[model samples]
Target chain A: MVDVQAHLPVLIVTVPLIGGILTIATGRGWKPWAWATFLTGTVFYFTIRLMMQVLASKTGMVSYELGNWPRQWGIEYRVDALNAFILLIVGGVGFITTIYAKLSVEKEIPADRVNFFYAVWVLAITGLLGITVTGDAFNVYVLLEISSLTVYALIAMGKDMHRGALTASLRYLILGSVGASFILLGIGYLMMITGTLNMQDMHDRLMSVPGILESRTVLVAFAFLLAGLGMKMAMFPLHMWLPRAYTYAPSAVSALLAATATKVGVYMAFRFLFTIFGVGFSFGMMPSGLVLLLCASAGILVTGVTAIRQTNLKRMLAYSSVGQLGYIVLGFALANLHGIAGSVAHIFNHAVMKGGMFMALGAVVYRTGRCDIRSVRGLGKQMPLTLAAFTVGGLGLIGFPLTAGFISKWYLVQGCLERPGGWPLAAVVLIGSLLAVVYTWRVVEAAYFQEPDPGTPPVEEAPLMMLIPMWTLIGASIYFGINATFTGHIALTAARSLLGGAP
Target chain B: MTGVLGIYNYWIYVILMMIGLYGVIAKPNLIKQAIALGLFQTGIFLYYISMAVIDGGTAPVWTTVQDGAQKFQGPYDNPLPHVLILTAIVVSVSVLAVALALIINIKRRYGTIEADEIEAMDIADRLAEFHAGAAADAVDEAAAEGHGLEHAHGGHHHG
Candidate 1:
């Protein structure tokens, strides 16, 4: 029999896929919720087990070859410290969000589709987790398609909330399918040159062969991959679909997606640049780093200002997420150890902070039946625990000292300063966060300072079931803020792994 | 003549793909956009299928001794692209299905399949919401326990 650890790699993905079918089988009411929660919890347990084993190993990578097939022909799952860190985010966020999904989902979706929602939610998580764990080139494309398809279904479930949800889902489906197709075509081009689908194998083979990097096919692949992934992650200009998709999706689904989906795009961009293309050649061949830098800077400036003007809370948060994504890309473009490490840290921090904000907003929507900023007036008095959780998340977004956002922006600026003539980029960073303050203040001011409408009736706080998950994420963001050594140490280790062979 | 004929597979795929892109971006009707998406996807499928072709190769299937055939010695067309295309085809079909389902919902809710008209409706809805929110704020101030509330007068001032 295969070693138990070897099974962990496949199990992390399979359990969720199987759980999804069983989730659908259980059908409506409490059964689907219970099934999905239990299944996601089990997946979380498996991910921790595999990650601990990888962390303890000297190599910091866990690889499993599928079906005992030959190396080049078979599919492989190779999880390094880089992806291991992502695994924890996906699993931890998946489990925590599932905990809060029941009440929020029941309110937002039609009764008949509740079970279907959970099934599709689990499927989307499976696709995301699969993308993280796989070590094959083509497999990433397949999993991307899988996740994109399921996400469209989940977003469409929010049609009951607004008719706009239907159009949003349609736009996302169209763009997402095109993006996935481009990635597939890029993978085809890579396969033509490398003759192997396995990522690690391709890396080694590409390095050994000289002059291949200069070929027209490789350049074409690079462009296609970057543009395709850029569109998926809502990179700077190509981010038109993102705000509406998040604004209109069921709160729980959007929380999970905003926490993980685009982050997976960030991961692919890193993998392609650092691992597949070999960092030296990728930056040297094309001024990719400079291009990314300018693009990311534009996203931060434009989206940050736009977020200040949104009256709908969810739409504002969606625009803010686009800005946050810009920060992660900026870290990569800086191409320093600290910069990449900061990006990794922000991945975890953003998942918690953003997820916390969306979850709290969902709780607000649950009670009041509205998502407009006016609905939140005097919410601080009515829902102290929920608003307090949101306050912490909002402060984190503004990068106040002693929060996760500060730590991320700190290292990212430090990464910039270390580069020659980098002060200008650092100024851009400060400018983005300054605009963040204005937008975050809008929500806090509305919730705490403004008076509640007299026509509105008294309201109770959100149920304990929702508060617990929301508080957990808020708490984690703070904990990371205080004790950086935990996420910080892992981030450094992962960054080092991607940057080189020796620490 | 040979040069032109050899690359025609690529030429057709490119033309179909552009046509599909036009349908998706330029078409106003939602159903038309969905059909365009299908056309775009079919172009990609053909592109992949063309990549699998070989000048003088047979099918990749292997023969058993009982079959008494030895065609395996010849160059076989690449089976991997074909396999990949099959998966892509499945993904594309499912996406199209979801798109159609969404269009039906849009038609029911918005009462129109034209993109511009739906956007116009959304803008109108938002204006109503803005006024409603303004009215709510005025009313809230008037209703609060302690005051005549200067803003309370503004509620009836919407005219």
Candidate 2:
């Protein structure tokens, strides 16, 4: 057990990676799905074990150097509270989505391509998990590409449903490549100055280099990194590629991408902002805090209003994701303890709420073959359980009391109130919630009140496979909502460590 | 003046990146955009390679020192960026392949590789759906609040 424990960091990533390539050989029918489900389940177990080890470790961190080489010369796998929390989220969501994918995949994707689909599916999860676990700066870029490339293929697989999937995938490829290249440029600039790729070593070297914060190259690098990561996370103005990509992808792919993709992007942003740059240089010596705050505030209002206008339910949820991510960015940009804690908590909360909501839509698509507003008409009585799951998930999105979202908004509001001259931000959060209500209400009214058109065929309820995983996440969101001790404590601990306080 | 000219490769990098950016944004053809993305990636590759250079430096290979020498004569260029860019180039090629495959699929489906034409087709499809849904919305007026407002104006304006 001790020997296995020591290799947990690398095992968590490589297990899925090798298993994904192996999945392509599983051939046709339920075999590929079963193999992927088992692989993701094992990965999820490893992530849980790794998280337990992180909590048990004295420093609240674990680091492993690859190939038994010195840290500065080789790649590293570092796991701390922040990333351990993210890894558990990606793992849990990946497993649930894989379970949900079997039915959706058999329906949406062609038969011969199903095995390859599962291969890319597991590979995508491997890339996301790898991004969250690695400690080397350049490795992040490589893994980012891995995830991005696999996602492009996954999104394109939706072409059978709508030909628009091709355009969406292509647009994402172009913009994602540019964004990643910007990050590569930024990292190259950093390496020129610090001469090291290990994140912790980079930080140490940056600190010792006098006035390096003011250097033009460093400033340019910061700008590029922020812009690139912002685009990746779908921050406000840079979110042009997101709505259509989510809307046109297959139901299972939508749930996985919505739940894990941008959240991992936010994790990468945190590593760059807090770990490598340090809080003082990032917030004090630079103007990033104010800039991020302003952009996030505007994004919250704009995307919230835009979400209300979407004709397609998936596109609406996609827009709402941008707004939700704005709240997370807003939380951290405030740079206070409560604010950063709120940011950390919302990452977990939003993943569950959004992932569950997307799964609910996937079920609707499974039943009716489309997720347009008109398709869900009178679904309340027909698919009661599915619509109810969607309604509760929607309520969570609106941050209704006794739901997981309220806990995040409650902390966010407290953070805003704690900072002087922060009442406007607090109002923005409330207003954003109101906008959520408007969009969620539109769907509920359509499903519950309106009559199904007589011309269309009657639809059945979603399969048991879909319902089980949908409620698992919805159930988690609510359970964590009422009992905030676990999430709140870890979030606070993560916030403290990010601010240079003792773990 | 010399300080600015000393990093002339950066100037070339900037130029290549701008040209690629312009092509991606301005060109309406999907194939052109894909090619432009490749150019943009090439510019970044050059940036990494230029950073690896050292004046009068040799390759980053170790050589045994002669008997008279206390240390190996060195001034080797940084090879790490070269190695990093090699991985990046592989990623770049994969992206190009995916983009081309997607473009071919688009052409097969829509019978056009022009982005503008494809977008026009998508817009027309959405408009058709909107009009069909609007006819039904007349039965339930209250439900026509959000998506209907914009598309309603579009219908009348287009008519």
Candidate 3:
């Protein structure tokens, strides 16, 4: 192995953690942002390298040992095709968010504390990377907290500017900590049963443990993991804190967290369910599938309706995020290859689309200083650059043809049809898409057709620094939609790998 | 009897978890909720620490021995769970710090740590914004009408 290549996994995460400290050392100002952006960019490069190396590997896995200890005794990073794809999404978004944060934070937050902003930002990015790359089961909990704690600070930072941001941040903190505690509880149960913390070793041991099907310990562990991840991902009923938190947070942080945080939670669900517990235990040994289906369907229908009632664009999009998660969960609920494929595809597509859209909204806030729908009236004529980006992203979010979202929903529909008596499932998907159209159209109509606001002063385009990053994500959303060769292949590989071996 | 006694520690964790969960769900004060969150996390910490102990094992430190001396060997308690719990405890502490910080900021902004009052404030703010928007629209319409009338008067005078 090349000398640099051998250190890729740890470097991919450590680069940002160190950068956060370096940024703190530099003190608050332009220097912190400069350090953060450069560090995030470096991590982004390493993340892509790790992805390529994993893809190129004959075994499709990259294992990096920490401190050179043996496998079971060491903290190891196991990179597979599944997490590699997630790395691309997380690292890529972190990089763009860093670039966008400079101008966005300058507008929304005070200048003196900008260093603190980038410091926490780097920590958040590293936390996410750590969560994705770690192979040890217990390491996931630590990494999960790394991101969750940073996220709480980031959200609360919005309090200085927005009135309710602190309350929203507090609610998220309480709920998020609860979620983390539950996950730790679940991990404890798994450890007691298997006597190992290494994920692969745990899987091996779990297979040998008798009475697993009827084991209440195993069942309770499963329940805890489900509820814990549900809280983290804001699944259906456990989603009250999300809309307020997203709406009240600074726009740049919103884009970053929206694109990556819950995504890590979703990835954990896949990792623990299929990779650790065995698919049969998660699906067949229990009635998890039916329960997931019911919750996902309700999440789709209910959140879709709720999103329509929101006046603040950010909250609307936030509720829309909940509804979108429903689709991803529905994929896993189906427990088929196409279903898993759709789930992974939406993970990529939705991240790009939401990143682009939220960043555009952030840009709009930078230029206009308002978030209500009315403020965007005739913004198409004034802030055309940001508005145009928002339009494409919104279109993709609505599952329009030639958009990333359509491909995801298409595969998801195919997944539904692959099951017996599946038309009702398919119908719900269609209705959700139509509901998305309504929300997207609400924005489009307000921007393009509503009478131009006479109360607000005219505004120019957002700065080039912000526009460039936003457009890059927007372009990727379309680029992936048009050419799914790379993403589609990876998604299929990941799905097959998850199901390759059965009990 | 030994098996039953062995299970009591697990029951303690369960009860602690339930108390934390109830506090998180039912507590009205934001700071209390944050503390409840910490307590909930502590339950997990307790579970992990308990898992580290083995029935007849010593602490996982190495003891020096003379060369080739025949001695009884016993297993050491698993150190990994202790290490894991230490990390989790750190996480739990940091979570508390962030939660308290957020509550402080919220109290500063809203002047109350009560969840209900804060929620009430939020509703009032939204209502206020709604009315403000309506008033702004009304004023804009009347100004437009007044401008149109002025243009008409100017045309008639020119004619």
DockQ, per model, reads: 0.34, 0.34, 0.30
Model 3: residue A500 alpha-carbon error in angstroms:
1.9
Model 3: CAPRI class: acceptable
Query: Would candidate 2 be rated incorrect, acceptable, medium or high by CAPRI criteria?
Result: acceptable
lDDT-better candidate, 1 vs 3: 1
Candidate 2 chain A, poorest ten consecutive residues by summed lDDT: A452-461
- For residue A485, give model 3's deviation from the true position in Å: 0.5
| Candidate 3: pairs in clash | none
For every candidate in turn, the CA RMSD to the true structure comes to: 4.0, 4.4, 5.8
Highest lDDT against the true fold, candidate: 2
- Deviation (Å) of A41 in candidate 1: 0.5
**Per-residue lDDT for A1-503 in model 1, tens only?**
75657699888998899888778889679889999999889888888988798889887888788887766888988888888888888998999999999999888877788888999999999999999999898899989888899999999888877767888899899888777777877787888788889888777877889888888888888888888889888888989999989988988988998899999988888787788887776666688989888999999999999999888889999999999998898887888888888889898899999999999999998898777888898898999998898889988887778889889988889988988898888888889999889988887898899987776766899999999999999999998898888788888888887777211
Clashing pairs in 2: none
List candidate 2 stretches off by more than 4 Å: A501-503, B62-73, B136-159
